[model samples]
Target: MSMLPSARLLIVDDEEDMLRLLKRSLTADLNCEIEAVPDAVSALTLLESSRFDVALADVRMPGMDGMEFLERTKTAHPELTVVMMTAYGSIDLAVQAIKQGAYDFITKPFEHDKLVHLLGKAFERTRLIHENLLLQKRVREQESFQEMVGTSPKIRKIFETIKIISNTDVTVLITGESGTGKDLAARAIHRLSQRDQGPFVAVNCPNLPENILESELFGYKKGAFTHAAQDRRGLFREAEGGTIYLDEIGDISPTLQTKLLRVLQDKEIRPLGQTKSVKVDVRIIASTNRDLAAKIQDQTFREDLFYRLNVLSLQMPSLRERPEDIPLLIQHFLEKYSKEFGKPLKRASDEVIQIFLSHPWRGNVRELENLVSRAVLMSPGEVIREEDLDWPIRETEECLVPAEVSFLPYKEAKAQVLEKFNREYVSRVLMRNNNNVTKAAKECGLERQALQQVMRRYAIRNKELLSNEDAE
Candidate 1:
């Protein structure tokens, strides 16, 4: 007989004897990867890191019972095949469990062969689900960026610009408020451009230190600086014959601004400490969430370079301005993140969708994606519900601090609530700035390093905050 492949399983029960019995039976009957947890809390912690094909949970236990556990698992991890174990064998309980999305029920002292049969059926079901998800992904790959999931006139117009200008090597400038999908627009342009086959290099301008940005942009020869141990090619060299996306163009200091202007004008670059300038043939696509015209008035950004980069301009509409796209985006993320997290979630409830529609998506498409990612990870039932979503609470401006600040102590319940807003606000700023702490700091009126500290404190993953310059 052909042996079955190893399948991961989570056995949740308070009875150590029962847990041991289940492990022994499953291991003996089939090749399995098993983790026996005492309760739902432990099971959830394990689920956070591991993907199990099936979770066999007891119906009754202290703290979170099996029924409750089943509800939570189905919500957050709909892809997981769940089976309930109960000693009482009550029909009402079994019916309730089935309603809550339990695969089936196994009464206490069940036959060993029956346990193996149930697992075999669950494994086959999981295999089919995985195969279907993979097929859907392949179908989506041809035209999905997770950014092009809208049908609004504003977004359609942006696509028109991409199609018209992508074939040329003209310097295209994309402008939008922070959270608008500028990065997506840039990538879309490149994907459809003649240079699609070329490398799509993305550089968040302000992320690199000003002192080193020059070398990062332009190649540096050996001995260019104290620690220039070897010759190094710059981003331009890396993007040669392709397109280099210069993000947060407004954040680049005036010094490097001049060098960048020369690169655009002369189509050549001089390596630091090298006499000869190398001729480079590359297309430039630059994006900025900042207002270059206003910066030009303030003299923080170069006017000549602004005109050079704006040879072909595309402006992305913000999420609030295009409410019609919200549903499409939510639906897209429901499928996108479902496949991404290995959890096939059901469509969001109307209440949840309404919340998404009514709320001002200040963070834009990227924010919506984050919200969905969180909801998918935390929802307890097969479908995402309102409580699973963490809505940003409204803060009062009357008190420079939270209105409850005086009544609360540091790290208290209300104080932690305040931190939540700060976390989200800082996250939006960073996403808007393309994770460039310098630019985000300048915009948020905090120091570059200070903004970074805030990100670290809230565990706001800079990389996880995805934004598309004007796509927000």
Candidate 2:
């Protein structure tokens, strides 16, 4: 355990001998600076002029007893750690002092080493509290500018885009894989925009049925549908003079797409139940993981609508593409989850961190956040370790082609050979590593995502490996 060399300690007691004794012990045993005071008045005066980490008070001081001193010190400086000293006859008073915010108490005839140990524990607690505060402050700072949580070149470019376009009224299209923080990017845009003061509405197009989704976006009259109990305003109206984020915009049906295109062009929306078109003054921001250009070619998505939505586009890079930022993201999630779960975990161990950096985060930041949250909740230690995580595993190279592959067509036979190789290779490797993806991936000479994709293609399950391991 490391000591805080700069920590200042106050020894307050009426007996000059007790004060001197404590000062001698702490100064000899601890790295902190110590001062001895004869009475509560001197301690209070010193506290006002200088900062002290911990205060050791004797219970029977004149004018102000240790109990009163502890209470006053707590009220004035709640962060300070206070320990009371009492005789054996007044053990009840020591317990009372503990109830009144005293960190701990020592008996009057305590050993010098025991007191030193107590002071060490107090200093350690103080250190942890300050470290937590500093970490929280850094978390806030890291996410303060537009609340984007990455420092990669790609993310920096997106930040620049947000800064330049936030002041404008241009529509933006954010595209990324699922869990790549598309919604967060949209919020950042809204937060930095001129209509930040207005309501920022969001609609998930795929979550609702076609007819219901329409009414949700464009409100229905009381009798428009079975569930429409009363007249309601649509998202466009709710987002008046603000931004409306349309998540999974590519998932909407052709009919809804046409209506959306009309709304985009005419700046008006006709509600399901209402006959009149409602003109809306709302900015549009859409996000999707689908390939809209390919959809247009496939005739599933409208070309004109695609052009309109793509006026200003920002594609969020996948987590694996920016491996250098993994450490920053991990620390951010560690702090976030620590606070949320009330465990307040510190950084991961070196081995755990190496695994984190090398792991192919298939689910991207979302996966990382979920893993950290789980670790913080379940980890017995204050720091995260490899055992605290559930990592994926890759296949080995022990796969062999079926005997019948030799009789198949040349091209078909080669495909069969590779498939058999991958399935067997991956499955064996997973079994060998007990289904740990990062370690298996490293052993198999493949990225975590590559191994995962192969496992997915073969419909391999980690449970299979775990069961085999159990059998072994």
Candidate 3:
């Protein structure tokens, strides 16, 4: 374990001698900086000027009671750990203080060992809370930039494409299956672009009709339409000097496509029922889950517009193609939902992770996120078990291949089970080692080429399990 810095402590008591004794006892065992105060007011003043890792206050004070002091301190510094000290300890008071967010309380005449143990636990809790805050901040920052969480080669390629396209003003076409994070890629481009400080407006082409979409894209004048209450700005004008993300762009009608192409060509937009065109400076980032090329060939989509919007392109890989990233994604989601639900779920079982790896996530990361969130909420303990998740795992068809035998004897059954276990173990080891044949062989105590032969015989090619480019 990594060594953490010493905790700063504040001790408050009405009795000066008791305060000195408490401080001496604590400082003798702890390497932390300790401050002793005679009253709650002094402690509050000190807290205002400086930060402390933990605060200890006596329950009975002349001016302000320990419970009130603890409550006020918590209000000021929610992250600070506060413990109450009481000579007349009551179970009711302890329960009430805990409910009010006190870290823990100690009865008066406490043992030296008990004090040390409690303070140690409090210090560790403070350290963990600090670390969790830092990690959460980092996660939030990355999420704001729309960065995907994966180190696989396939994901790295996607990241590279985003990096290259973000510096340019060219139109981008993001193509992928549904729920494959097309909008996330668009946001990443916007965040990295020169207009990063400008507004990022997203409009779904499939959600609105052609007439409504035209007016929505280019603001209409007041009274232009029956429901037009007043003049309103469209998405393009709202995103002036920024970027406009059009999701599901393939669903746009052919007539609308022509008008869109005109806007791209002219760099201007004319609102509905308006004669004059409005000049706009906005970058276009369009995404679709369909094959626009096939649509253009079928005459449903225009080739000119396709060419216009296809200045740059990015493709998102499916979860099934990058199974190695599943564990990281699971960890990410677990942390997210555990904090969200106020439950600290530690880890998923190996069986649960194996099920995740084997299943083809048709809905991609979105599906995995939802499943993990539900599991975290439903789980009764710190660890998330396979039974806590509702993920579909078919035993007979999805995982197991049939054995060639009409009736299996005990010996045959035993052999089949052992063979299956060996194959599964070998496959897991190879995957965990990123398909490094030599490393996996050494780990499994087998010859390098012998492991390779077993993998081949089991139909578990390295390329099939992990992408060839990633394995390299």
Candidate 4:
């Protein structure tokens, strides 16, 4: 029941005296701005000129009565709240006005207090509408950059971090598993940077051989190689004054690593079969699914190159880490593919949602997008069902039988049920993770030591779960 002091109200009636009384009383009681007009025509003219929160009109007015005014007002400004005023005999007309789109009706000679209460509720509705519109505007602004959608604290923190670092011209190393949106994050940084007007070039490192990748990164001079028919500018040169995202940087060969290190140290690249180095101005943003630290220890990747790339590191969280965002992501993809495919699909079924929440998203966001896209395209009904989804349900997910059941005591039955659940759940988690205890422990929301204790209780040995090659 909060009153808006700034709420604007419009009152229309042919009776000057009635309009005067209403304008005076309502203005004082509601503490809101009031505009009174003699006829419905004048009121419509005033409405066309100014915005109003609520309108009070007489149902018996001549030459365009309140009912017509209500209809026209609703058609023009659907958000506007209107209440009809009528004489005692015209209560029927007021009821018809309600059917046409009147907020509510008040008879003539009504108590001023009743009108004030009704108008207060109407004003609150207007306020709520305004607030909801503002909220939706903000959500659209937040999601305008890319498909990186999430309200979880981790994702919000990443958003904040990206904004803070966007203005700075520093190397950013985004490390995460494949399909974790590392490329999207790189594009977001480039879009927000001052050099946003320039081109953003992406290079998939593992996609090409070392010799070709080197020539592609640092363009070769004409006649530099077999395809020397034309002079070409490499990806770095193409991204001048912008950003060049080197994806899967960990997979590049040692020779390429050394060349990349030199470029990082001095902002210059020596193109393949070229005698001189060329200076280039481009921001470097690299991402990798491989563990660069492990590669460094194994002497496969250069430590100096790793140090240069790891200047400002951003580790993307896997989809399973932020399960709260799964529903939002699903809805986003559903709407996207639905519109693209011209389908009338609305949402996924509850069973489908449950399956998504429980399943391990190893392929992360990309896997979810592919699954949702396929589901939306293939679903026969508007609602996406479990059967419509192509995701395989694990055999471990089958019903856990209380084998030691059949009229057993309540305590004994409960113990057996708990034991069965623990064993099956642990086995399922381990199987999914390739018998990797650390990963299984994390999926189970337990520390390695705690999971080991549970495993001992169930006599579950990890070695037995491993494949023959892995065990050997």
TM-score of each: 0.60, 0.63, 0.62, 0.64
Between prediction 1 and prediction 2, the one with superior TM-score is 2
Clashing residue pairs, candidate 4?
none
- Candidate 3 vs candidate 4: the TM-score winner is 4
- How would you encode candidate 2's per-residue C-alpha lDDT over 165-221 as one tens digit per residue? 788888899998766788988998899888999889999886678988888888878
Task: Sort the predicted structures by lDDT, highest score first.
Answer: 4, 3, 2, 1
Separate clash counts for every candidate: 20, 8, 0, 0
lDDT, each prediction = 0.81, 0.82, 0.82, 0.84
Model 3 C-alpha lDDT per residue in residues 203-252, reported as the tens digit of each score: 97765668899889988998898999888788999999899999988878
What ranges in model 3 sit over 4 Å off?
Answer: 1-37, 41-49, 53-147, 223-226, 342-346, 395-472
What C-alpha lDDT, on a 0 to 100 scale, does residue 149 get in candidate 3?
82
Error of 1 at 349 (Å): 1.2
Candidate 2: the clashing residue pairs are 392-436, 392-437, 393-436, 393-437, 395-425, 395-426, 396-425, 396-426
